[model samples]
Target: MEKKELQYIHSFEEYVNEFINALIAYSPKLISAIFILIIGLYGIRLINRMVKKIMLKNEFDPTLSRFLASSLLWALRLLLFITVISRLGIESSSFVAILGAAGLAVGLSLQGSLSNFAGGVLIILFKPFRVGDSIEAQGVAGTVNEIQIFTTKLLTSNNQTIFIPNGILSNGIIINYSLQGVRRADLVFSLSYDTNIKTAKDIVMKVMTNHPKVLKNPLPAVSVKNLTDTSIVLAIQPWAKNADFSSMSSDILEQCKDAFDKAGVSIQPYTIEASK
Candidate 1:
């Protein structure tokens, strides 16, 4: 019994000594890993700031700049974490392999989400449209409210909010109404054949020219478009700023109607013919 107790004490002492030696050997590496992590984090922040400044200087879109900075910062932090693990004597190859496997699994599960993210990246880079621009795409017409990673928010003219997936938006044809500062308002007005065409055209042109919103450079135009059985179709085209297009169109229509009524001009009412 005495010999057995001595052997146990001797084993315990050796184990303790080995643990202490290992701890001492690893302590400096642990400190170095921590120090590197701190410095790496600081460096990442500095790089992010610098990148943002450069992007701003280059007139990059604000949304794209923010997204790029965040992505870069996270990637750098991930690399720093892997480096710290390696410094602590962890096998980096297995760790990286595990990360790869996990990423693959996640990507497989969220294929649609990944596609949307890629689409968002493409949109930010290409700049098909910008926030506050009026756009028509995917069968919806609205002003771009926000551009997100997976979806875009649109505020429709009828005050409806739509969330369209970036994947579909990026692939579809986008009609940006606000890209051009000015837009042409094409309106067709019908007058009875008995009314003088020259007088009607003069009246329409005068109304358009007098309007505050209409642009004088292009010169508003009114011309006879077509002759029908009961009426003459006049095509009235006026140019106005995109922002004022809707209101200007409405105002012109109202003013034209009032002017024609006061001037004793008759507007023809359409009567659909029954199918023969």
Candidate 2:
């Protein structure tokens, strides 16, 4: 019994000595890993600051630059972590494999977000629309307030804010009303079938041409449109600056109504013909 006890204690002492030796052998590497980690952290910060300065010097877009900086920082940190692990004599291949698998799973889960980010990059690169532009997309018409990495913000006419995913926004139909600085208002007015068509058209044309907001360069004019059973359809086309389009439309209609009444031309409601 005494001999068996002595053997157990002797083995334990060997293990303890071996462990101490291993620790001693690993100390230099451990210290170097820590030192490299600290130095790498400082270097990362320095590189980040330099990159920010370059971006600013080049007048890069603020949101895109910030996002890029964050992505670069994380990527550098990951590389540093791998390097430190490799220096510690731990098998880095398995660690990297685990990280790759985890990254793939995370990427799969965030596919939609990734798509939005790609769309945002396209938008920022091409600049199809800018902030304050009036755009209609996905049946929503509003002024673009902010452009983000995953979504774009819009302010509607009623003051409601809409967050539209950039993925759909970039891929979908977008009508930018303010891009050309001018918009055409298709105004349809109905006149009594019996009234003289030429006279009524002349009156509308005179009113539109005289309006300050209406553009005469394209030449505002009235023309005969679809003829209904009860009335004649008159289409008044006017070009105006984007900011004045709404008010100009309203004013032209009101002023035309007064002009029509004074000229003794009868006005009637537009009637659609039934299908045969």
Candidate 3:
């Protein structure tokens, strides 16, 4: 028992000495790694903050700014981790090679995602439309609610939320109704063949001119669009701010009917169902 105890004590002393020697040899490298890690983390934060500020100053979307900053922060942290590992005298070349291979595999698997990311970048760089803008694109007409990294959300008139992938959105044609700041309501009014064209034109002009939403500067115009066997088509063009476009169009149509009736102007039996 005494002999075994002596052997155990000797083995413990050897272990302690070896451990002390290893610690002494690695202490400087460990300290250096820790210092580098601290400084690298701080530098990464500073860089991320600068990037966010620059994006904000450039009026970049909040969604894009945050996504980009977070992605960069994670990438810097990964690089710092690799650097610290390398500083500890560990062979990181194989690890780096493995990481590269993994990244390539991930890239291949996420090709569509990468395309979306690229498209999102393009969207942010080029301001085609903005949040709250009423746009018609991809067979979807709605107000833009949010622009995300991979998808854009739109709130429809009926209050349905839609998520459109950025990849397809960027590739397809976009119709921005609100970009022009004003929209023109083109309405065609049909009257009986025997109705007086002069009196009808005068009534439409007066109704459009009196409406508060219609722009007076452009001076609303009326033209004889078509002459069918049963009716005379009159085209009424009025410009209104986008926000008031739909309401103005509806109001103008209703008021035109009343004005025509009061003026004893005759309309086609089906003219009330005219399409705009």
Candidate 4:
């Protein structure tokens, strides 16, 4: 019985010794893995900050800056992840290939988005329109609020917000209303056939010329455009600042009405057809 008890104690001692050694050997590797993870995250943070600082210092466009910063952070994180995995005795080539293949599949799935992204790059480089500019593109007319990689946001005059794809906007013809700094308020006024055409033209021209908002450099004019059986058509063409278009248009209409009344000019009414 004594010999059996001594042999049992010896076996237990050996087992404990082996277990402790194994633990001691694994502790360094576990600590190393933890360190790698912590360092990788720290590097990512550092890279993100650096990229932000660089973008801010360069004064890049807000949209572009954000996009580039995000891309940079992802790229740095990928590199760090690869490094950490390599340190853990893992072959990174297969992992990289798998990531590449996955990326390709996703890219194929988002072809339209990729096209818009390409279009957005061109837009940023060429700068066809800027923020706050009133533009007509892709059948939408409004003031540009923001330009992004996939779309552009606009706020219309009626307080409606619209989003247009960047691909369509870039490819289509964009009519920038605010580019010229000035616009023409083209209006047509008709009068009865009995009214003196020359007298009405003179009165309208005088009113437009005296208006303060009307630009004098382009030389405003009022001329007879067409003569129908019942009325004579006159075109009032006046150039004014873009910001003053609406107010000037209103003023011109009111002034013309007052002038015509004072001059005893008669406005023609629409003729109604009688049943046969």
lDDT (CA) for every model shown? 0.89, 0.88, 0.88, 0.82
Residue lDDT tens for model 4, 186-237:
7878788888888998898889989999999788888887888778887788
For every candidate, C-alpha RMSD to the true structure in Å:
5.0, 5.2, 3.8, 6.8
Model 1 ranges with Cα > 4 A deviation: 1-26, 225-231, 268-276
- On residues 66-152, what C-alpha lDDT tens digit does candidate 1 reach at each position? 888889988998999999999999999999999999999999999999999999999889999999998899988999999999999
Ordered by TM-score, highest first, the candidates read 1, 3, 2, 4
Query: 1-276, model 3: which lDDT tens digit per residue?
Result: 699999999999999999999999999999999999999999999999999999999998776687788889999999999999999997799889998999999999999999998888778778788888988778888999988888889999899999998899999999888998988888888898778999999999999999999998677889899998888999998889989988899998899999999988887757554322
lDDT of 4 at 70: 74
lDDT of 4 at 181: 86
Better of 2 and 3 by TM-score: 3
Worst 10 residues of 3 by lDDT: 267-276
* Clashes found in each candidate (C-alpha, N, C closer than 3 A): 0, 0, 0, 0
Which of the predicted structures, 2 or 4, would earn the higher lDDT when compared with the native?
A: 2
- Candidate 4 whole-model C-alpha lDDT, 0 to 1: 0.82
Per-residue lDDT of candidate 2, residues 177-223 (tens digit): 99999888888887887789889988998999899999987889789
In model 3, the runs with Cα more than 4 Å from the true position are: 1-35, 55-71, 88-92, 266-276
Where does candidate 2 have its weakest 10-residue lDDT segment? Answer: 267-276
